[model samples]
Target: MYILGIETSCDETSIAIVKDGEEIIENLIFSQIETHKIFGGVVPEVASRLHMEVLNKIFKLAMEKSNLSLKDIDLISVTQGPGLVGALWIGITFAKTLAYALKKPLVGVNHLVGHIFANFLRKDPPNFPFISLVVSGGHTEWILVEDYDRYRLLGKTLDDAAGEAFDKVARLLGLGYPGGPAIEKAAEKGRLIFDFPKIKCERELDISFSGLKTSMLYLIKNLQKEGREIPINDLAFSFQYRVIEELLERSFIALNKFQTSTLVLAGGVVANKYLQKRFSEVSKRENIKLFMPPPILCTDNAAMIASAGYYLYNKGKVDGLDLSADPSLEIF
Candidate 1:
């Protein structure tokens, strides 16, 4: 069966066609990073307006690029939550209308679960009974995935997500928006000289980045008071080192506690070179397998939504006209 998936949970407006749940026929994403950069970050209202303007064109492009027509699609899958309400409504309403017009099955997917299924796009997909880490712009979470659609939440960030921390630190250093890539580039030219204190909570797998972010800001402000101009590159490296170290430390602990044989990382933060390297090194030391999806899949994509939708579709789980965007949708 073929599924056409739509994703507009945030700043990206995406569309994709998946065949039989395994093959991605075409995945098209139009990013608003450049547009939002001037505003320092994504403005919810602007994002919603942009989605309203481009979603229809994107849908057409997705189908054309895949060399298929809407009539060839068997089902429609769309993300319906945990994002800006306006942005979510655009995609949700569009998908619902398309599904109704085509008389196809409509599956509303959770944005977080879409990130987890990103692993399926990898060459060596992580098996069941593995530890899943989803670190992104708005969220940081650890989940135990025993099967498709079956999950147990282990821990999550109580404050700002790792990606949010990255962006805020980058902004402080005069770096551009979409801060992860900019920070990674700067870190390459510098060394981690300053050691930032890591946050340790009573919970084993839980994480907190807000404290780290605050600490860095305070340190930088103090340095300025001393009439010292900080090296942006060194600061970037120091920040990344602490962030990645925390992620590695918590992941290792969870792997041992869960006795899982593999580790799977998803969400946009997975694209950070520092986290990727740290995760690989830590996983190797523990003799646990690691699976990371390609960079494209790491960010929001309809292909992952379609992949997740396949599991639900097969189980005869479909939504009716009552389906609407749930801004607080929980991941199952």
Candidate 2:
């Protein structure tokens, strides 16, 4: 089956064609990182406008690169929500129009679920009943995946997500935008000297990062008040360490509580080499099967959406032309 996927959930304008959810015939992505870097974050209106401008070009390129015609696509998949509302609408509208024009089956996929399914693209994908730690710029969630369509929300961030905290902290330290990569890069040359407070959630599974971000702010202010030169790399390393440690601690708790042997790391934050290395080390020590997609698949893309849509479509999950963009859509 050929599935054409559209993803404009945030700053990326992506279009992809996937075969059987496993083979990616062509995946094209146009990143707006450079455009958003000046602002130190994404502007919803700008992101939406860029998506509109480049979406058609990306779609055509995907088709051309794959050497496939519109008629060859059997299903249309799109990221429907939990993202910038304007950005979500652009992809949803384009997808709805294409599905309507082609009379193809349409599936509006949850962006987070699409992240989880990115693992399916891996040659050695994890089996059913796995624990997924989804950490990204906009979200931090723990999910229990019993099957392709069966997902239970195990826990989530109560305030700022891990990626949001990273961005906020990075900005505080004069680091550039898209904080995960920036912090990771700075952390490479530093040591974990600063002792940032760790996060403690009221609920066992729920997590919070607002407190951690606040702590970092206070620390920086105190250092500045003392007329001391801030150790940017050390601060970055310490902050990243605390953040990754919290995630790892929670993931271990979830694995034990749910009795799941396999652990899947999803979303853009998983692209951080430090996080990946730590998770690899711990998962091996604890004898847990860990699965993570490559950096290309970790970020917002259409291939994962297409891969997810293939399974959702087969399970009789289809949407009508009236499908609307849901910015706050949740994966269940």
Candidate 3:
């Protein structure tokens, strides 16, 4: 079966054609990085407007690249929630119209679920009953995947997500947008000298990064007061170190508690090479299978939406004409 997916959950306007949720025929993503970089972050109004402008062209391109006509698609899926509402409405509206016109089933997918399924985009996919960590710009979560559509929420962030923390800290250091990559680059030239707080909560599963972000801010201010030049690289390294250490610590705990044999990492934060290396070492020593998508798939994309959609489609899940965007949509 062929699945057509559209994702405009945030700054990225993407579409994809997946065959049986296993093969990606074509995945087209139009990232607004350059446009949003100057602003140091994504502007919802600008993002929605940009999506309105380029969506149709992107649709045509996705169809053209996939070499498949609308009629050839068996179903249509669009990310419908847990994102900027305005940005999501554009894709949801377009997808609803397209599905109606094509006379195909339409499914609205949860954005976080889409991230977890991104693992399927890989060649050697991990088996079920795996520990899934989805750390992104907007969210940080741990899920126990029992099957394609069955999941159990293990833990999630209590405040800012890992990726969001990265961006905020990067901005404080005068780094550009997309903080994860910029911070990683700076850390490479420096060493972790400062000790940032390690997040801990009574509920071992819950995570926090807001305190870590504040610590960095205060650290910089104190340096300025001392008439000392702030070491941007060292600060970046220390900041990234604390963030990754928290993630690793929590992840290991979850793995042991859940008794899962595979660890599946998803979301934009996985793009950090340092994080990957740490996970790689753990995977080898702990003898746990590590499933991480290529960097391209690690970030937002429609293929992951399509992959998750395929599972929902099989479960007889369908949305009606009244379907609308749900920005606070929760994934269990």
Candidate 4:
């Protein structure tokens, strides 16, 4: 079955066609990073407008690249929630129109769950009953995946998400927007000198980054007050270290608590080289199999959404035209 996936949950306007939820016939992503770079973060209004403008073009490109027509599409899948409402609405509306015109089935997928399912696109995907760490700009969550469409929320960020913290700290350091890559690049040339406080959550599986971000804020202010040169590289290294440490610490705790041997890393933050390297080393040491999607699928894309929609559709999940975008939709 060929599934047409539309994703406009945020700044990215993506359209993809996936075959049987595993093979990607065509995946097209139009990123708004350059447009939002000057703003230091995504502006929802601008993101929505960009999605509306580029979605059609992206869809056409996907079709051309895949050499497939609308009639070849068997299902329509879209990211329904847990994103900017206006942005989500664009994809939802476009998907509804296609479903109506093509007379195909439509399914709304949770953005977070779609991230997890991105692993299925891999040649050797992780099996069921695994633990997933989903870290993105808008969310930080640890989920226990019992099976496709069955997820148990183990823990999540009580404050700012890891990606959000990265962005704020990057801005604080006068780095460019989309802080992850900027900080990652800067940290490579520096050492981890600053000893940022480690977050201690009430729950063993839970994660917190608010205090860590505050600590960085004060450290920078103190340096400015003393007229000391702010070591941007060292600060970025230390900050990235502390954040990834907290994430791995909680991940280990969850692995031990659940006794799950398979671990899946998903979301935009998974693109961090440090996080990937550390997780790879630790998972090996602990004898836990780790699965992560390629960098292209790491960020927002329609392929994951289509893969998720395929499974959901096979399980008899379908939506009507009344289906609306839920910005706060939860994965159950």
**Per-candidate TM-score against the hidden true structure:** 0.97, 0.98, 0.97, 0.98
Candidates, ranked, lDDT = 2, 4, 3, 1
Candidate 2 lDDT, 1-332, residue by residue in tens: 99999999999999999999988998899999899988878999999899989999999888888888889999999999889999999999999999999998899999999999999985667899999999999889999999989999989999988899999999999997888999999999999897877677788889898888888888889999999999999999999999899899989999999999999999999999999999999999999999999999999999999999999998889999899888899777
Tens digits of per-residue lDDT for model 1 on 185-229? 999998988888978877978888877888888988998999898
- Model 4 CA deviation exceeding 4 Å by range: none
For residues 143-228, could you state the per-residue lDDT of candidate 4 as single tens digits? 99998879999999998888998998998898877899999999998898988877888887777877887888899999999999
Better of 3 and 4 by TM-score: 4
Error of 2 at 284 (Å): 0.6
Q: By the TM-score metric, which is better: model 1 or model 2?
A: 2
Pairing residues by index, what is the TM-score of model 1? 0.97
Off by over 4 Å in 2: none
The predicted structure with the larger lDDT, 2 or 3, is 2
Q: Of models 1 and 4, which has the larger lDDT?
A: 4
**CA error at residue 162 for candidate 4, angstroms:** 0.5
Those runs of model 3 whose alpha carbons end farther than 4 Å from true positions after fitting are: none
Global Cα RMSD, each model: 1.2, 0.9, 1.2, 0.9
Q: Please report the TM-score between candidate 3 and the true structure.
A: 0.97
lDDT by residue (tens digit), candidate 3, 254-321: 89998888999999999999999999998899998998888888999999999889988898889988
